[model samples]
Target: MSLDLTCPYCQQPFQLAGEQPGKHANCPHCGKQFPIPASEVRLSRKVDQEPVPQRIAPATFWYVQTEDGRQFGPVTEGQLQAWYEEGRITANCQLLRKGADQWQWATDLYPDLHQIGEKKPQGAAAAKPPPPKQALDRPALPQSAAPITPLSPDDFPTTGAGLKSLGPVLRPLPPGYGEPRLHSFEALEDRRKFAPFMVAHMNRPPLNKMLLVLGIANFVVGTLRAVLYFALFLGLLGAIGAVDERGDERVANRAAVSLGIAFVMFVLNIFVISGGVGLLQRKEWGRSATFAGTLIGMIIQLTCVCVTMMLGADGSGLASAIWIVLLVLLLPSILYDAFAAATLTLPSVVTDLEE
Candidate 1:
């Protein structure tokens, strides 16, 4: 590199090859020899003044030397220039100088800048600019005198620096912002049961879309099944009543009476099915109607089971037992739906109270 025709020591304009990094160069005018920044001789430093409010940007970077435990600014050009003018370079301050090949740091170069005047400007002391935000942080900012702009993802460094390039810049998220939210839904299974329960059960009012749908479907199906099954049973009973069997009158009467009783039972089953469906659907009318029907169905089934065991044939007894088993099977779903429907009803009840 070419140098101005002046001596660095005396400001003489004489020119020479720029001093090799470590060589000591002398000026003909002043005979002063200053060591060039290199391995052999280094300019040690001391901080002449503490950081001033105007001198330091709200945010700046500093380099620390591990060997000597001194901090210096290499990238902060303005701050470094100020320190240089202040003659703060000492034997203890950290220095990070870039060489032809690689960057080297030294701690015995200057004093800490903290010794400078510690006073800061009054009223509107410089405030640091806010940092970037992450996903898990605040969803939005609150309304305030000065609105804050949200940070973008691009503000953060995605890759770390390496031997070939500068290290990654890691800017901390600002206060009031939260951590990044998890991107994957892999953990959703763990929360499935609890999430639904809370939405369905705990919130003063229920707001579950799935539960509501299920309740309604149950009511519709139950009503339809009740209509069909009771219709079939009654039709069979009517046919029996119309029969004129030549057999013993006692036999005919018994058969006709049993058929009548079964028809009656069928009529009741319709009500039970209707009620169960209604409760599942979470309709207020359905919930109540089903609850009543289920209880009655249970009673009638148990009674038929007893009657069959005492008077009917073994097949009849088994059929009655099977019917009882079915009734038992339906009991839990009916009860749960009743409770759920009732739970849903509570909100309306509360609203009524408020009104």
Candidate 2:
């Protein structure tokens, strides 16, 4: 009689000799090894019987702490092994398995994760020095060994007799030898507060200096213009006074209007000069004022350019060419204003200023 058996891996059925019952044999259909069932057991099972399910345990995960006191979590064991092999994690790193209450040193917890170097064959040659013992391999000192005692001033030698009487003293090592060094996060945060300002000051960009120079130049030009306007106003006042009683009313009215315009321009120029000085000093308000002036200047330039373009459309070719040339000449000032605005608005500069 032949005995029937099912392969666990492939679930294929095959037959063996009755004498081969309870013996391992390769399945004919799947070529897999399986134990031959006894004749009595084989007769009890039907050909349509369902395969039994195998129970397997779920995968385990671990958490790790970095040298910087950062906690990385729920990582698989394989990933930890990869990190260890890649040098991202060190032997001194702490790891805790999922659901574990305490952490352990990685090397002590998973010794098999790292490979041991091959041992040299014993021969008639000089023997190599023994490998240094790992921290894990060090045996704990017995309780009977000397207990830790408080240190006294006598521990230090001030005189020759004190030094001679002091013998070798064994002290207990401090706790958490493999732990990461402690660092104060608060100190780091405090330094960060001023870091941006210090960096900005140390490496002041060329653009900022250019903006300052532009501001100073603007102030000087405004000062000269103000002086010229003031002189013109005084001259206009004297001319009005010298006008004959019988002089034309139209001429007198024109002089008064011109004087008023000059006075207004002088006052406006004073404000412009002040704004320029503020810009040179890197004041926040100075930046705002300078930006406002730049906008006004740009608007006036655009309006003039548009009017010239329209008027020159029907004028001589030379007139049109002149208008184009004027526009081109004004482009640099407009671009400089834009550059200054952008430089002042930079985050580093903004952070350096008071609110």
Clashes by residue pair, model 2: none
> What's the distance in Å from true for residue 209, model 1?
11
Q: Name model 1 segments beyond 4 Å from true.
A: 1-204, 207-235, 238-243, 312-355
Write one digit per residue (lDDT tens) for candidate 2, span 80-140: 5445544555544566665555556655654533222222233332432221222122232
lDDT of each: 0.45, 0.57
Per-residue lDDT of 300 in model 1: 58
Per-residue CA lDDT of model 1 for 49-109, tens digit only, reads 3454554224333332322332333333334333333344332233444222223322122
State residue 103's C-alpha deviation in candidate 2, in Å: 43
Q: What is the TM-score of each candidate against the true structure?
A: 0.29, 0.33
The window of 10 residues in a row where model 2 has the poorest summed lDDT is 128-137
